[model samples]
Structures are given as structure tokens and as C-alpha cells.
Target: MDSQNSMRWLNVIANIGVLIGLLSVLFQMKQDQELLRVTLTNDYYTSYITADTSFAGESLPAIWEKALLDPKNLSLKEMRIMESQTFAPINRWINLYRLSEAGIVNESFWKSQVNLDAGYYLGDSYGRAYWEVSKEDWDDGFLPKELRDHIDKTLLNRKLNETLAYY
Candidate 1:
């Protein structure tokens, strides 16, 4: 074969090799995602609760119902308080994994990032729920100490910043 033809063939072979490598990489990623421990059963439950109740679990739903029924629990718009009892010990871990998967950290930061994420989610989720019940009457403050305590304004901001550091 002429030198020109030989060069063309080499270029074509290199391109083919790159395509195959990319396909393999994509397939491997798909396999890893498939291996994710997140189960559909749990997803179904969480989605149903969020969509129908504007809530996340049975305990919170039950408390909301009880609060609505009981006259003593009722108070002026801002003071009525109901407790949230999350269904499992799963919330912290799951939120951490979600944050990590979004590339919030490098592998070396995984442990600390996960810890911080737990604190972030704890205060944020409770604060969100409290806001829903109180409208805007409640200040930007987090939930009552009795309900959750992994966060303070200072610590929470630190966790958020740390999680975003790898970016």
C-alpha cells in the first residue's frame, strides 16, 4: 500500500479505537448506576407521600392530622407546633448520598461531606416543614431544639461551603 493509503488506514483505526473505548466507558457507567442500592420500592413510597400529602412520611402525616383535630393543640397562626417523626433512620444517609452523587465532593472528602450533608438536610428539611405550617410567620430560624439539633446557623453554612469546595 502507498504511504498515503497506509496513513489513512491508521487514522481510521485510531478513530475506531476511541469509539470503542468511549462505548466501553459508557457501558461501565450504566452498569455502576444499575448497581446503586437505591430501591424502587422506597422511591415509590417517598414520591407518593411528597406528591399527595406535601409531606415525606407517615409519622408527619399522622401528626398533621392529629394537630388539625385537637382543639388544645390549635393556637394563633404562628405558635401551633406539631412534631415530625421521620419514618426511618434513612433520611440523613440518603440525602448525603444524593449530594455526593451530584459531585459535591471528591472521594477524599466523601466522609466529611456526608457528615455535613446530614446536618444541612436536618435543619433545612425541618425548617421547610415548619415554614409550611406557619407560612412566613416563623423566622428563618431552624426547627426547635427538641425536634432536631444537628445544625446551627454557623455550622450549617460551614457544611454547605465545605460540600461545595470541590467545585
Candidate 2:
């Protein structure tokens, strides 16, 4: 009887240990998920800053201003520069849209990004003109239908000469 009691107690202790082990693993996994989210957010900001500064110390700004005022009058080289500059933001938007769709990015953050993109890309005259010419190039499998629809809806509502306010 003593041996049986001892064995029963040992089994209960073993079961408790197993339960504690499983709980530890779950806690660790949650921590790892949160860490991943933080890492991705950091990487996103780093990439954005890099893109924003890519045209610094160059003549692109003057060309950009000229294009913004009169896109049709730009030379071939100026048009190419405009296209290259536009690509950076477009690529960022596509990446953010994909991340948002994958649940890696929060909806509110994604919506804010979309709003900013709409203000710059759909509201400005040169941006709208660029989209009219370049959108067809993105009709390949790379651009998702849902994102395209979202952009088109934003474009429909924006004015051609609208500008983004800093405040």
C-alpha cells in the first residue's frame, strides 16, 4: 500500500511538471511574436527613411518641380527621372499593402499610410498624370486587384491640384 501511494504521488508530480512545461513554451512563443512585430516595425521605418533621403544632394527636386507644373513639357530624361523617383514610394505602398493583408501590420497603420499616399499620389497633378501613364505597367501579377481598386477609389475622390498640408 505504501509503494502504491508513492507511485501515485510521483505520477501526479510528473503531470504537473508537464503542464508547467507546456505553459512555459506558450509564454515564450508569445514573447517571440511580440519581438518579431517590433523588429518588423523598426525595419519599416528604416526603409522609409532610406527611401525619403535617396534623392538628397541631387538635381531631382528642380526636375520634380518642373514636372509637377508641366509634365507634358518634360524632356525624355526628365520624365525618366520622375518615373524613377515615383517608383520608390509606389514600391513602399505595395509592400505595406501586402504586409497589412498578411496581418503582419495593423489596419490603422495601413490606413494611415494609404491616406498619405492618396494625398501625394492621387491629389497632385504630376502624380495623377504619372499614374495614368504608368498604372498599366503594374497590371501584371505583382499588383493585387484589391490594392488596385483601393488606389482607383482614392484617385476618383482626389483633386488634380490638391496639395498635402504639413500640419
- Top TM-score model: 2
- Indicate which candidate wins on lDDT: 2
**TM-score on alpha carbons, each prediction:** 0.33, 0.79
Q: Which sections of candidate 2 miss by over 4 Å?
A: 1-9, 139-141, 164-167
- lDDT (Cα, tens digit) per residue for candidate 1, span 81-116: 233222222243344344345654233333453344
Tens digits of lDDT, candidate 2, 107-137: 6675577666765744667777777677777
Off by over 4 Å in 1: 37-71, 74-82, 86-131, 134-167
Please state every model's RMSD to the true fold in angstroms. 13.6, 2.8
Error of 1 at 108 (Å): 34
